[model samples]
Target: MPRRARKYAVRTTYATNAALALVLAGALTACTGSSGSDGGEDGKAGDSSASPTAAEPGKYRTLPKPCDVVSVGTLREMLPGAAAEDDGTAAPSAGASPYEGEPTATYDTDRRVGCRWKNATSLSTRHLNIDFERVVSYDPAVSDDEQAERLYAKKARKAGIPLDPDDTSPDADSEPDPGSEPDSGSKSSGSPKTDSSKKDGEKGSGHKGGTSPDGHTSPSGAPDASSSPEDDVTDSPSATPGEDLAPRSLDDLGDAAYIDDELHTADSGLHRDITLVFRTANVIATVEYEQWVTDKHRIPDSQELQERARELAAQLAEQFED
Candidate 1:
């Protein structure tokens, strides 16, 4: 071969070898990258294997299967005599006329009544007791109606009171007006009648002068004396305050119901129980968790578990109406 041609041939063979080596290197790198990505995806899916395929945003995230039992007990110790009197009357002991049995009540796993929980994510239960001795007595000389009106006026004044108009006309659809005059002139005429009869009926009858059984009343009759103002000022049955008996999961409770509340979780285990105590307000709730193990090498994530427990306790505390 010519000298120039031989040199060109040698250079071409070297260049071809270098290009082939580059292609092989790129192929090996692509395989490694693909393997790594697959491994990562598998690991993530495995970690979440216990999670439901689809769940509502705020619903139970992961509940224990087969259910675990949690016990709750509550007691209302009698307040001292002085404290009881301040509440209204002597604190009645349990088994007294109004209250029966021990002041304390208990509910075990078998006798659960108010306890409730989400099927998979949480188990919740609670109990409550009310110290009757601590109840305050309310006294008012006037009737309930008068008391109520006064209370209403007081509240209204505090909330920007408005003037009450003096319109005496019966509301539309009221009965015919009873003649107002007692025929005083006829009494001297010896018509065999006296004012006593009329007054007695007016005072003794349960019905108010202006108002009928259906709430229809003459606008002119003195505001029914039968409607005791005292009743109005006194606490209504619905207004009475006491601890509730419902056991609710943390997610289902609101913030106002509890005070000095806290939650904690264990550092390691396939199962964990969260204890929540509301000391000052006298409320307590417990939540238990069971982990489904997918791999022996994998351990429960402590940080994530604790965060979930806190969220549950906060939700339960918010349900109070104090």
Candidate 2:
């Protein structure tokens, strides 16, 4: 072979090898760059993971049966009329079962349940109802207790009871609308003209008919003692704060609580409804007691019924602690 041709072939081989080396280096650089970028992204993800931490779970996930929470003793006292026939008769009358509670219908027992009792005697008709709700928050941002607190706040407002001004719970995150704001100018459906428990906050059942202790609603500021519940000791507000038996927030019953009293005259007679609502952890409980007497001259005693309702509420609150 000629020396020039051999030299040319060797140079070509060297150039080809150099080109291959450059290509391998470029590929290696790309791989290293991609691996480094992927590692940086993974590190960033790990650093921000704690910022979106999930909210804590609620205290209670299951609710007890509503009918079972309230016992027969409460029913007996609340429904005294049921015992009226028992005293004279040797055997149980084939009448409405008074002590056997009627459970409210609901699709979900774990989430909500209620029991209602109604007893009618010749003198007065008594009604008792208990409701239990186990609140749940689908959003990961909120908890069950917080959701329950909000629900209780809403219930208080609907009943015309004011939210506690000093409530520091998460539900109190924003100031509640004033409950004193005149009710939508009209009474709610089937709701009669009621004297709010807050109505006598400063006066115990204060005079409603122009400083007169009668159950008349004097719209003209004129004293109309000739009301249906006239001359009754349980008339309107105008007394001392000690008798402020109107609808008001309760601080002692549970995590939060309130009571509502309403009096309205019906053809059967004048009836008074006393209701209590309380919250514990993630559960909300309600105790509503009603007394209806055929006599219009006498109204249900707020203090008496309120005391009983509060007692029952406290009992139910203790149950949720378990």
Q: Which candidate leads the pack in TM-score? A: 2
lDDT of each residue in 104-124, candidate 1, tens digit only: 222221111122221111111
Report the lDDT tens digits of candidate 2 across residue range 7-65.
99999999999999999999999999999999999899988884676667768877777
Number of the predicted model whose lDDT against the real structure is largest: 2
Error of 1 at 199 (Å): 74
lDDT of 1 at 124: 13
Q: Count backbone clashes in candidate 2.
A: 13
Q: Candidate 1 regions off by >4 Å?
A: 50-322
